[model samples]
Target chain A: MSECCGTTATIEAPVEPRVAGRIRTVALVGPPNSGKSTLFNRLTGLRQKVANYPGVTVEQRVGRLNGIGRGDLTLIDLPGIYGLDSYSEDARVAVDVLHGEMPGTPAPDAILLVLDSLQLRRQLMLAAPVLNLGLPTLVLLNMSDLMEARGGRVDTLALAQELGVPVAKISATRGAGLDAITHFLNRKAEAEKPVPAEGRIELPVMGNPRSYRQWATGISTRTKYKAPLSNEWTKRIDGVLLHRIWGPLIFLVVVFAVFQVVFSIGQPLSDAFGEVLNAGGGRIGALLGHGWVESLLIDGVWRGVASVLVFLPQILLLFLFIGVLEDSGYLARAALIADRVMRSIGLNGKAFIPLLSAYACAVPAIMATRTIENKRDRFATILVAPFMTCSARLPIYMLMIAAFIPNTPLLGDFFGLRAAVMLSLYVLGFVAALGTAWLLKSSILKASSAPFILELPQYRLPTVRSLSLRLVDRGKVFLRQAGTVILAVTIVLWILSHIPFHADLAGSVIGRLGQLVEPVIKPLGFNWKIGIGLLTSVLAREVIVGTLGTLYGADPATQSLGLQAALRHDLTLGGAMALVVFFAFAMQCTSTIAIVRRETNSWRWPAVQFAYMSVLAYVAALATNQAILHFVH
Target chain B: MVAIALLSDFGVEEADELDLSGAWKLRQLSELPIGTVGVVESLDLPGEIQHHLMHMGFMPEARVMVVRRAPAGDPTVYSIDGFEVALRRDTAGAIRVREYEGQNTRQG
Candidate 1:
């Protein structure tokens, strides 16, 4: 009975007739680690759009199916879920979208269910619920290449009969056997006949996982599906990677290498990018001939944009390393290694990834918290993520350390006083994050207990296409920030500084506001100039470097000196130390604040977060400045 | 000691059973040594977590093997239904498993 109809005819005959343009949306759904994302990337290439679902942080990724010569078709990649039961927010959104009940998303006309063939017995459990939805579905057995290599066997024709759906074997990573997808869609295009009642398979009791599992097991047995032999490499690798001693030792080394690369390689690349932007701005400014328009466009707009844009290299590099770690399955191992430490701080091991990535930038790091299933744990992670000392804090820390700290050797030639201070600042930020997480977890956001259930995926080599796509996505997000919030803030600062049409630097509107703020920061040993930097840095943490550069450049006494020399001449040792300390603890970046608002979906959390961090920063800076002053005297 | 108590309790429940040779023992999943194989008997966790574990192929009668443990030795990895899942000791303690004699039980 299963072999009576050919695969092509069976798939084409069931799709319900809709108007030509109405058959536009197709949903791609699968359980986690089923190669669903790899398939999505293969199908969509560069035409994907990522956004959040209405009023929630769950990402909605839709792309044009142009790779298969179907530009008219849209593929909506739903979140990877175990079942359609609404136990989590991800499941709820997936359920809503599939039922066409989601507010803004179009209901999918068909479904592409990707399941890992190596684990087909367990994965087949999902097929029952999805097939019951009555949408035209194509069951794609992804990783079929690996399955075959490992001596796993599956009779697709028989399996298709058991599920009453079309089943195709394809390796998403290898980009092989994808023509079946195009064929299915092409037939779906010309499919005008209504689905026959006899085509439906007898599904298990809905919403019961035990019944689903039993039903799935029976199907696999009848279809003669053989489970693949466990991959030997994975077991051998885990022996060393998860060893009692060697695992943690290797994890530390990997983390240290990532930061070292970000500073050693990424910094020089950023400096070169900065120089190019500067030279381009110079040429454009010379064309305008030293007028207010030139200053507004070059110094005000271009400089501000360029300052933030220069960090793109470091950000992309960090994201590249993170993407590789994630794709190759090493990140999950790292999380496992870090689980005990995280649990002590009232967070799950999954929270470790976001906090680790927070060292790059807090925006994406906050977005990464969506993987943490517990709401309180997720929120607590987000609240402390910005304290991890992002790359944006590097410029101010370097400037302060270079000006204030002498190059005295601390550990022979291997470590010096300056390096020690830099390391201490990093440690300080991490300690603050841990402490804050503990407080939040123990206080209002406390839960009964958050369970940690992590699935460790088989290790695979990271693909070049996937890594490049990740870098491109991250680069786009960073550039968008530079173009929008940072650009607007720069333009506004320029306008304020030039309000009287030709006012002196000290007498401008922003300058007056800086003087007004000086009294509040006086206890922390900061002057009006540092006051201005602090105010502008609320828009972006690194803008302080640019603000200070402009302020000191306008001062005739320090105009000839480099920024480090000018900073040394103007600031006391205590004030300079206090400045970096303030940055280390404060939530200053507008981008971080905006992302927090979007992620938490309320102003209350970000508002409380900002106020608490600012208070902590103020007290810490005051204590640092006053202690240094007293000790020196 | 706790494993023995749990085994005796299960023995009372299966009093009518024919396999009275003491070849099978009931224990928490966490008590199983690395490379040991067992069948899931029940999950005593809370509602949401139990449902989630079941969805991840931890239903009763499924075969699960202890694969490895993390470096810090808290979350142990178990192979169930052709995939590896790591559960902390506390979560693992909530799962009851039936370990039969002559099964794979390699000592670590």
Candidate 2:
């Protein structure tokens, strides 16, 4: 039947037209890994921000769906949630948004309920509660391709009749049968009955989960929907990949390979990127001539932005691997293997993925901690997430290792002494994360963690489209940071270092400030110049390299004389090691602090985190410096 | 002898009564022989943990089978409701299970 001529169209609309001139908001909701994101991407395509894991998308991503009859249809992709009663942050956000209680967001005009076709009955439990909201809703039975491939059946027509809503079978990943949903949406938009009528079929209150399951099962049986068994191929793969002995071994190798690839692959790309950026900056400087304006443009802006961009290669590789791992469902298996280690630190297994991601970048990692259901555990994870060796620290670590550690092959030419030193720094970050988490869990946030119950989605090949989109989105974030926060910090630092028009940097404002702090940090074997780098690095850890580059009177972008050469000329071995240790323990990223504030919804925690990390950094650096100097003497 | 020792570690007093025919015994889901189908008897975890597990399709009558365990033997994968879920041994220990009596056991 046509949507307008359907029996439900007979009732007179009692509610005001919600789509007058204002944009209509439609929310796409579903269970985890049910292809909700794929459908959202298909509907909104490329005009969306993607966060892969469930409960991690704290920021509500509203994308524009054009030509949907509603003048401007805003499609909000809510985080995948199992049900309304769960205590996960995503559930609360979903409930709050549906109730129009979330500030700055109105309740959705309609809900696009996505369900996994193979697991209809299980997913239907979520649909029941959503139906009770009385919103204009349509169900999309997604993954129908997999369903048919596995000899399963889902009668969309029968399901529509039973649920009293429009239903369409779609394979979101393959982009099949999406037009039907678009047509249904257009019809709903034209119907003028935005608000559901009181006589609409009431969804049974899902007070007893067993009863809800029975109800869902009854509906499915009548429709002749027999859920196919788990794929034999998946079982065979899991048998080996998740094997008791081999699983952990493979996980370690996989993680080790990721880091190896990041450094091995990323270094060359980063060097090439640096060379191009430096060439560009040098060309711009030559064109503009050598004045204060040229200096500010080249030394301040260009170099500052380059410092951020140089890490792009590493960041890209990291996210690419993470996207593949996450989409393939191996991350859940990895988490299972790490659960023992996680519990020892008073964290659940789910925290492992986020902690692992922190090695690439802490910003996304902090955001990824939302999947931890317990507030206390989530908080503990977020606070320590920054301690992981992020890609931003790569430049500084590489610089230090190059200057201090020899490149002689230690274990064959594949593993050099420098590589071991780099690995040790990463290990230090991990140990710090675990130790800090243990202390915080045992002392401050003493509440017990929620049980680790992770649903392992079927492993599948991730589409190139989603992977590229992820890479592009992450690239955009890095560029945005380089443009805004990093730019501002660079300009301010440039002015401070060049103020009073002083030819000698020692007499500049920043130089004076560094001198004042020099005595305090002298025990750590840092001079005033090193002190300034430490101060500026608070904006971003990479800024320390740029700050030092400028301090030593070298072009920061060109790496003229190279950073390692300059550091080796200026810093003692003990001082260089101390600086590395300091950066390792310090919470140097303002962006990380801002995210921590937003995620925890409290400035107090960020303040505590910053203070604690600073103290720890200072003490660790001091001890390392003293021990090294003592041994040398 | 090793299998018997491990079975005894499960403290299944009635392990002898089960025909010694390789029919699974009553044991914690963590100790349950992997690949052996069993019905969820009860979840003895703390209230919040129990509630969270129940919400995730682990009701009283649900049939769960161990799929695999990690190398550490701490988190084991279980298949139920036609989907796989990984649970830590500590959390899995809270749930008690009884082996399916026959091959025709009802699926969840």
Candidate 3:
């Protein structure tokens, strides 16, 4: 488990306070969507990934404040919350880090409060509680550009005098006024000792939030600041986007376009990359000349990396769309539109973002569930996320539909029989996910209903530079996974497949394992070869096509026909459909299970996830094969 | 014109408490028409819900406007302090508000 998941009990002495060899810790705290993450990114510069939206920063993200105090000042970017009170999990995390109660985090030497300057009065309600903490603190009035655009200005000096803290006006999105923040941190870091004026600060009028708001309003009057006019264009756009009749229709069209991009754009790029890798591997094999080194280089390392690298296009495109949607603030409106339908299935609107992302890949989708506040809602969302047909299942689906179903048009050139089967599979995946959540929520995970409160932030254009940086970071993560776990698994499976070097694969260790499991899967119309493909595919779903290719002794270069033609010669139509149905529900990826364990912080949930998915796959495949064979064969 | 006519029909009842002038009519926020602005009278809800609402800037005497409703018209969006917050109608029912007359004239 990562440091973020460590228990709250373990507390080592304050590490950063000693300052002899360690860096100073300064926590950046703010309310939801106040540009705290954007400021963190600007201060840390391309070294950190900006956590966008509310509750997205579930774990602690510490970044180095470059060029400040021996370049060793660590800036901890915390989850955006309303205040210090423990009303939600994200709020609790902020409180823990502020008080140094969480394991592996030391008491902060300073607190930097990032507030949206345009919404100063509303945001200052949060400012009062944090100011009462009384550590060495500085206030950052962010979004000065928007404030100016709305014909308003902030009296930074007057506000600073009233609050007894240094205040700087900055635009985190445009990278303005960051040097003032650096100077503030440097000045605070060089102080002789940590300020101990804990009880010196008076309560803002009184202790409760009502008094805090009153105090905040009073302080606003001293700054000679006028409330900026709210963005009328956002509400205008919402009139159409959040319309009673058109909102849901537009949402469906947007979702359809995303999937179309994922398939139409991602498929060719994957094929092109696969071809380049195969050509390079083939040349290396010829040079090494028919030995274990040749086999290991061509079949083990190259193939493993190739399998994982193929999903790069889909991952990049998925994050790109997600960035645009979230940065534009349309995701909140979509969640609101989806809330009505989702509530019928026992989930709140907040689960919609994670659930939608699951269509591209389940790993990131599962991670995105951190934004959901309710524990039961988050768990239910995670457990059913894998049931969505991810990009990994595309290869298996395409191979099956192409090899089994004819290319006859169903409704014009637009909708072919093959396309119909693909669409049905996606719909089936969503239906199954919804059904599982409904069952789980009503049965074992039932609890008192939690109220849903989602803030719909104003829309803004997504900058090209930030979007490209996010795209690159997501691509890097996917490639890194391909380099490590996926690479290792391929090598291990390669060794198992090639043991007893003198004999054929029919007599190898993997061959024996396949034969052993053949009878168990035979009821689902899978023979020994299919059994072997299923076993190797547990490493990744796409590996089944490659495994079937190697098992049939076909050339890997002509990927279009080698596997498809071989499968056509080997399997019946009923069996092909059964395989596709099985792949849809099977928990095939080891990385997904690993992520589940880490996210849930338990081995039991992943185990339960694996068991339930496998059983569901087996039963569905059996029924599918039996019905198809009885009617057609 | 229809919304204005509907607003003018609200009946105000006199209160025996200290300073209520019998000029404001109290109503559940969920009962207000879309786009109507109201001043929060009080949040008669469970302690946790009330605390969370206050923390989110839905304080007593704060002006809130009913922005829009979901497709099913159950969870409605309310604009408070320039932020749009969407919550279920059942949750909104716990909030008591009086129609805003230019500004909040009643003092605590």
Candidate 4:
């Protein structure tokens, strides 16, 4: 039994006439797990636009209230945050947007403060500071359906009286009680008189969490709030899922299943996609037959764009799984389980999801680092993500292993040499990532103390609409990158290789540049043609195979041989092994570099990452080649 | 105060051993067994972490139940104010709590 403090007396006067103006922009603010995003999707449907805030990686999502009968009313979904205190980047962004301090974002004329009714006693702590902002505020108790079903109770009329604002208990998931929002907006838009602030309860001291909690507890008691019982299924599931013995084992199984789906199923889908694109490009090329325009359009732009687009299936598959894990709240449990292992490497448990996703593509994985709250930990994770041996490295590894390693059985026909080499390459990338993370944590990016505070939200079934929206958004990001940066790089490479028009492959500008760098790579057992492959592979790690195929096809001496035969004839055992090793460690994907730059909001990080990884790759490959040569001699 | 006099009669002399209400003994949150509830007394952590934990419903007088330990047993989950949150052993050790004596086992 605590009494309301004295701060709310300042707002006891009638709401100013300007405050009742038509609500053009509404901001949705709430803590994590409050179902704020779900309500946003419900109100806006398919009309949301997601972008980053000015000069920050935090996402700024704004959409129109199409379902609320006011298609012109804009709703800005600020990042979910615990408090307005700016300890993290997300909270800072939310604070800026609410106060109209952020550039390129209109000031929210009203605020929709959504809280979980089941946890209103705790969540109501946010209402005090927010109400102090003096914007026309509506407190939306989301998840009220689940709350009531679990025996929770709340007196919305009494609560609204206490806070001096409208309170609506609605379930965003069930689409129940949503007409309250429309009614509120319509009434506010038509009303022009001053709103009398009667029955205004006192607020706690600003920025003091203890006083806020006491104030919240007093309000809850007065409102007769009854919190729901803990979900029985969540407890039972955690008893097994977080068990000492079963938890880690199940985590392994889940991770294995994710990768198996992404590769075993997604690979065939991607291959089919690639084939379809190639066939379509060929048909278009035949219409404009035999000219530089055909070559540029078909071989340069079409092939490059198609190769990047082919990854859409695998990226979507990875995101589908990520979306499910995230929406169902299993991602938090996974982070808790992974905290120990990740902490040993100087990263947080939340880093595990992004690192796990890096095996598919670093672009999405880097984007996934937004879940990490600490800026240092997020940056460290982003810098090391590209070393996780993504799918792009598979083609080069497969080609080299096929040309070099024999299929000799190592252990009674169970494991072959080729499989051993491939596994070793995977191991190499993981080790490099771990070692680099350790180095960074010990030196430049060291935090004063590691603070990992994660809330384990109650599990729920993921919605199909939410998952599909996630996939659509991810597909858009991947395609936009391919159409811009990848397309530009492809056009530039095409022009350089065809300089002095119709020149032989050896006499082109790119070939001369490759020969110019031949002396540097000779120590690693690479020829000038391999140097050219290295240069082209900077566009994408998988592009090396196509570059080698084209370069060797253009040579009269090796034209009669198959691509694999030509590679085997030109490269020694040491060089072939070194080539795969180089691909294993190098940061060769421009997509990853571009994403890293965008995520870090500076080129310094990607530049440093590229340089460090390249040096390491060169040194490792040199050791690999010289050691094999010495042993052979 | 009554419990303090009763404890004094049993030869316990340290006033610091009891919380302000003298109904329960004060201990670090990590020392509490699973299923046992405690009222948070104070936080001895750094400023940012302390604020964050408080924002997460770890304020003074808030009842928190030790739910379960992670698989490796370093971080433990605690239920506070109708929600569950996980904290590492070091962080939990900084939170001072008094063993709760209320009959409502599930209510926070």
TM-scores, one per candidate: 0.91, 0.85, 0.87, 0.93
Better candidate by lDDT, 3 or 4: 4
Write the residue-wise lDDT of candidate 1 on A559-604 in tens digits.
Answer: 9999999988988899999999999999988878877886787789
Runs in model 4 lying further than 4 Å from the true structure: A1-19, A194-199, B1-23, B100-108
**Number of clashing pairs per prediction, in order:** 0, 1, 0, 0
- For model 3, residues A315-402, the per-residue Cα lDDT tens digits are 6777888788878999888889988888999998879878888887887778667767777888889899999999889888998898
Report the first chain's TM-score for all candidates.
Answer: 0.92, 0.87, 0.88, 0.95
Q: Write the per-residue lDDT of candidate 2 for residues A1-633, one digit (tens) a residue.
A: 233332332112332324422225788899877888777767876666433223343656767775233335678888788777656667788888777666655567788999998888778878888887777788889988888888888777887877888888888878888788677666675664554454555466565665666667667776778787678888787777778777778888998898788778887888899899999999999999989999999988898778767777767877888789888888877777788888888987778878877877787677667657677888999998999988889889988888888899999989998898888888998898889998998898997646677888888998998888778776776666667767788799889888879545768888899999999999998988899888888878988876787777643533466767877777788889899999999999877776677677667999999999999999999999999999976
Give the candidate number with the greatest lDDT: 4
Which is the leading candidate under DockQ? 1
Greater lDDT among 1 and 3 belongs to 1
Candidate 2 at A466: error in angstroms?
1.4
Question: Tens-digit lDDT track for model 4 on A1-633?
Answer: 112222232222232213454566889999888899889988998778887898888888999999676787889999987788787778889999888778777777788999999899889988988888878888899999999999989999999999988999899988898998887777666666434374366878988887787788788888989889889899999999999999999999999999999999999999999999999999999999999999999999999888888888999999999999999988999999999999999999999999999998898899889889888899999989999989999999999899888989997787999889989999999999999999999999999877899899898999998899889877887787888889999999888888977787668899998999999998899999999999988889999999999899999899999999999999988998888889888999878887787778778999999999899989988998999999975
Score candidate 3 by DockQ.
0.42
**In candidate 4 chain A, where is summed lDDT lowest over 10 consecutive residues?**
A1-10
State residue A318's C-alpha deviation in candidate 3, in Å: 1.4
The whole-model C-alpha lDDT of candidate 3 against the native structure comes to 0.77
Better of 1 and 2 by DockQ: 1
Under CAPRI classification, how is model 4 graded? acceptable
For model 3 the interface RMSD, in Å, equals: 5.1
lDDT of 1 by residue, B1-108 (tens): 333333323122233243433766899999988888776878998877888899898877666889888888889999887789999999999999888766644321
- Report the TM-score of candidate 4, chain B only: 0.74
In candidate 3, which residue pairs get closer than 3 Å at backbone N, Cα or C atoms, i.e. clash?
A: none
Q: Which stretches of candidate 1 lie over 4 Å from their true place?
A: A1-22, A198-200, A367-375, A408-414, A556-569, A598-603, B1-22, B105-108
Lowest-lDDT window of 10 residues in candidate 2 chain A? A8-17
lDDT of residue A423 for candidate 2: 87
